[model samples]
Target: MPGRYTLAKSVLSERKALHPSELERRDLPADAARAVRSLAAEISVTLDANAATAATLTDPALLHHIDTRYRELPATVHEAMRPPAGDTGVTIIGSIPLRDDELGRTPIDWQQAAAWAGHPERRCASYELDIVMLLLARCAGEPFGWQGQQAGRLVNNILPTPGKEHEQSGASSTTLLAPHTEDAFHPQRANLLMLGCLRNPDLVGTTVSSVRRVELDAAQRDQLSRPLLPILPDVSYGTDFPDAETPPIPTLSEVDGQHIFRFDPAYTPLDDADLDYRTAYARLTSELERVCIAAALEPGEVLLVDNDVVVHGRVPFSPRYDGTDRWLKRVNIRLPQRLRPAAEATETGYGQCVVAPFRTTLGIHT
Candidate 1:
C-alpha cells in the first residue's frame, strides 16, 4: 500500500503555531500563552514516560491525581455545563464547589450516577464536580447553552462489569477508547475534543492518538479516497438503542479537498476479502495505527485531541468498583454559529443535519 502526505512534513507542529491574528483574537495573553507552552512541554515529557508503561491503556494513579485535583474547583458547577475553552483548546476549572444551594435541589449519589432516562437533573445540587473545560466542546452545539446535551455529553463511564452485558458501553476498569473522531454522526463536527478527568480509574486508561503528520502516505490517502466506505451505525453510538438500523455511511470524506477519516475501527465493518475496497481498508487501518501516540493524563488533567488532525482512543483499565473509581466530567463544544459556516459543519453522507439526533450511534447495531 502506498502512502499520501501533504507538502508539510511536520503537520501537527505547523498547526500548533497559531497565526498572530488568531492569537490576538483569542485573547491569548502572554501569561496564558506561556502557560499553554509549559503545559505542552509537560505533556511531551509525560508521553515519554508512557513509553515504558504497558500499551493496554491502564494507568490509575495518574487518573487518581486528576480526579482529586479537579474536585477542588466549585464555581464551574451548574445544572448544565459547557466546556471552557481558550486559545489552547482546553481550560481547567479545578474543584468547582458545586453545592446543592447552587441548584436549589438535593444532590444524588453522583459517585455512581445511573444513566438518566431522559434529561437528568443537574448534578449541581451538591458535591464538587471536577470539571475539565474545552474550547471545542461538541460536534454540533446543542439547543441551549454549553450545559446542554449536545456539548457536555458524557460518553464513557465506570461500569460495574468490564465489557459484559451490563457494562458494554464502557469498561468496568480503565480501558482505552479506540481512536476515532467524536460524534462522527453529526454534521456540525467539532475540530477538537476536551476530556476532563473527575475520578481516577483504578487502572490505566491513557488517551492514544495517531498524528496525521506521522501517519498516512500518498497511496494510503488515495486508497482512503477510492471507495465510499460504509459506516454502520453502532448501538454504542447512542444512549438507548434505536429500533431500526440505518444504512452504512461513508467512512471518509473530502473536506474542502482535504482527506479526513471518520474512523471507527470497532464499528466500521468491511469485507475486504475482495481486492478493491477491502485492500484499501486494510491499508487505511495499518497507516492509522503506525503513527499512534499515547498520552496518559493525571487526575485534574484536561487533555485535548484535535479531532480533525488526529484520531484518539484509550488504553484498557482495571475497574475495582471502589468509591474512587475513574470518572471524567465531559463537556463537548464547537465554535459558535458566527465562526465556521454550516457547509463546513458535516460530511455529506454520514453525519446527520446539525444538532438533529443529539446523540450519534449509541449502541453497536447488528
Candidate 2:
C-alpha cells in the first residue's frame, strides 16, 4: 500500500491540476446582499463609536448584543441567506459591501501588526467581517474559538507572513495545505467553520471535499468507524502544551444519522500494524480527492463550511511580500449545547480550554 505522504501528495497533485471553473459557485441574492451590507455598515458605525479593538469586539457581552441584533433582521433576509441543500457541504456568500478606504489601508508589515497594540485599519476590517460571520453563525449555531489557537483571538487573521509562508500552516502561502477538519485533534471541534475574505488579489482557491459525496461500502465504512486512528494537535496551538495525543477515535462516525468526519492527513498518524485501517484510510483519501471542489473567494465574500461533513485545504499560490496578499478572517462556531465541559469557562467569552492535561488519551489503563 502507498504511504500516507504519498497519498497526500497524489491528492494534492490532482487538486492543483483543477481550476475554480470546474467547481460550483453561488452568489447571495441582491436583496439579501444589500441587507447584509446595510447591517454591516450599521455595526461598523457602532464599533467605531465604541473604539472597539479585536479584544473588546469579541467580548461575551458584546457578542450577545450582536447575536440579538442579528436575530432581529427581516425574515426575508434570513430566508434569502439560507444555504442551498446538497452534498457540497459549503455556502458561498458574495457581494458584501466593505468600504476599504474607510476601514483603512492594508498593512504591509505583518511583524509590525504583531508587535503593535493593534492595527487600527486591519481591526476595522476584521470588525466588519466578524459581524457578518457572527450573523451567519448565529443562524447556524453559536460561534466560538480556542484560546490555545491563534492567541485566543476570535477573529483569526490568515495571511502569509514572511518567515511562515513556506510552512504548513494557515498562514502559509506557497505550501499546498492538505485537506483536513479544522482542529481535528480536538474533541470540541466546531460544527461550522466561517471564513470571510478581506482581500485576495491573487485569487487563490480553497479546496473542499465532503464526506457526503464519497461512496463507501459497508466494509470500508465499518473499518473507518472503529476507534483506530490517533490524531495529533496542529502547530497553531503553541508548543508549550503537553505531548498527549487523542484517544483512539474513528476518522468517520455517524452523528444524528448524518456522516461526520474527524480527519487531518498531516496530523492523524496511521497504525502500520492495522492493514484494514491502512487500506480504508487510503481509499477514503482517494475518494475525497475524486470529489473535491475548489472555491476562489473574493473580497467581501464569506464561505460557511459544515465542519463535520467536509474537509478543507488551500492551494499553493505566490504571495507578493507587498501589502496586497490574500487575507481572510476565520471564526469557528458550535451550538451552545454542544460546548464541552472542559471548555465551558471560556465558551461564553473568547473560547479557550484553560484546564491543563488538555488531551484525553485512549487505551490508557490510568
Give the whole-model CA lDDT for all candidates, comma-separated. Answer: 0.37, 0.64
Measure candidate 1: CA RMSD.
14.5
Most accurate candidate by TM-score:
2
Roughly what TM-score does model 2 have, to 2 decimal places?
0.80
Model 2 local distance difference test score? 0.64
Q: What are the runs in model 1 whose C-alpha is more than 4 Å off?
A: 1-168, 171-176, 201-203, 214-217, 237-250, 336-366
Model 1 residue 76 distance off true place after TM-score fit, in angstroms:
16
Residue-level lDDT of model 2, residues 1-366, one tens digit each, is 113323245445524432354344456667777776577658766653343344434554456556678876656556534543557778776667765554344444333333231445445555666667667666656566566765555556777877666555787878888898988766667767888887877678888889988988999999998877566566676433233433566787764466668888776667442888788888999999888887778787878787878999998888787666777778777644432333222222212362211123211111
lDDT of residue 293 for candidate 2: 85
Model 2 stretches astray by more than 4 angstroms: 1-7, 13-26, 47-53, 80-84, 99-122, 240-245, 271-273, 336-366
Q: Residue 181: error of model 1 in Å?
A: 1.8
TM-score computed on alpha carbons, candidate 1: 0.52
Local error of candidate 2 at residue 213 (angstroms): 1.3
Query: lDDT by residue for model 1 over 15-55, one digit each (tens)?
Result: 11112221111122344333432432333234322311211
